[model samples]
Target: MNPPFDRLLADVLACRHCEALLPEAPRPVLQCHPDARLLIAGQAPGRKAHAAGKPFADASGDRLRDWLGLDEETFYNPRRVATLPMGFCYPGSGRAGDLPPRPECAPRWRAALLDALPAVRMTLVIGQYALRWHLPGSGSVSEAVGNWRAYWPRPAPLPHPSPRNQLWLRRHPWFETDLLPALRAEVARLMEDPAA
Candidate 1:
């Protein structure tokens, strides 16, 4: 029997509702297994990711993998972890970094995609947009991320893993000192568990 998730994914890939609004038409990109154990929810793709048709396929991916204590192979393995952005397509770049993801993508697809990944045990919400969407009423990004404990056993908020934010990382040493160890341990535990 084919799983309903296959159809759900197909529908997402075929989306073109925002085609005319985009500089480039939507190319929704994501990776997951119906039985994935972990989900990495992030902002929209950058130009590089859009071109590559892979999530986080640039320097940002390097930092993210370092944070997770994972290699590219492990991180991209759908059975182990899934990568689904709050918005899937690249939303074009601003003067600084990439523009915010298209608002339409999430409201249209997030719930359905999440519902399809029934085995997801943990969701790592990265960046302000993801934090806002997943952890509503949490106030500022710092406040929401600082209170990571509140979402224990399910979702964990994280700063965007972009080299562009290296200054932020340096200024907030406690993120590495206090959170990285625990985060790594939790990830290790999940990876080690056959049934996870």
Candidate 2:
């Protein structure tokens, strides 16, 4: 059966509501199959990803793959996992990090996207913005990510895999000890059986 999500995704890719506000306009990059079991919801693309028109094609991607125990090929495979962002385009950068994702993309597209991925068993919400949107009212990023056990079988908040956050990782050794193993195991299990 052709899942309803295909149509929803088509609509998302066609979206241009905030084009004028964008520095390079919205490109809405994402990858998924209707039957995907794992969902990776991130913040907007960095300059690299926006330019390349691929999701997670930078240093952050390397760390994300490491955390998930996936190679580039497996991470980009749509049948096993989906990579959708809070915003579709590069929202530029701030003094500390990249700017927040454009507001329109998620409000306009996220529900439809989530509705379409009915088989998704785990959602890795990367970065503060993604965690805020996916797990709203969950307090600060540290709070939400720290309480990873609560969002089991649905969404799991993760710190951004960017090298910029290396200091944060060093401070929080428990994340490596506590979360990475479980996250990797779940991802591996899903990749092994997309239907699971």
lDDT of 2 at 152: 72
> Could you tell me how far off, in angstroms, the CA of residue 122 lies in candidate 1 after the best superposition?
1.1
Cα displacement (angstroms), candidate 2, residue 42, comes to 0.6
User: Compared to the true structure, candidate 2 yields what TM-score?
Assistant: 0.93
- Model 2: residue 4 alpha-carbon error in angstroms: 4.1
Pairs clashing within candidate 2: none
lDDT of 1 by residue, 1-196 (tens): 3468778888899999788767797898799887678899999888888999989999999888898899888898988899899888888877887888889899999988888888888899988889888888877767777888888547898889888787878888888998888888888888889675
Position 161, candidate 1: lDDT = 87
* Cα error, candidate 2, residue 172 (Å): 0.6
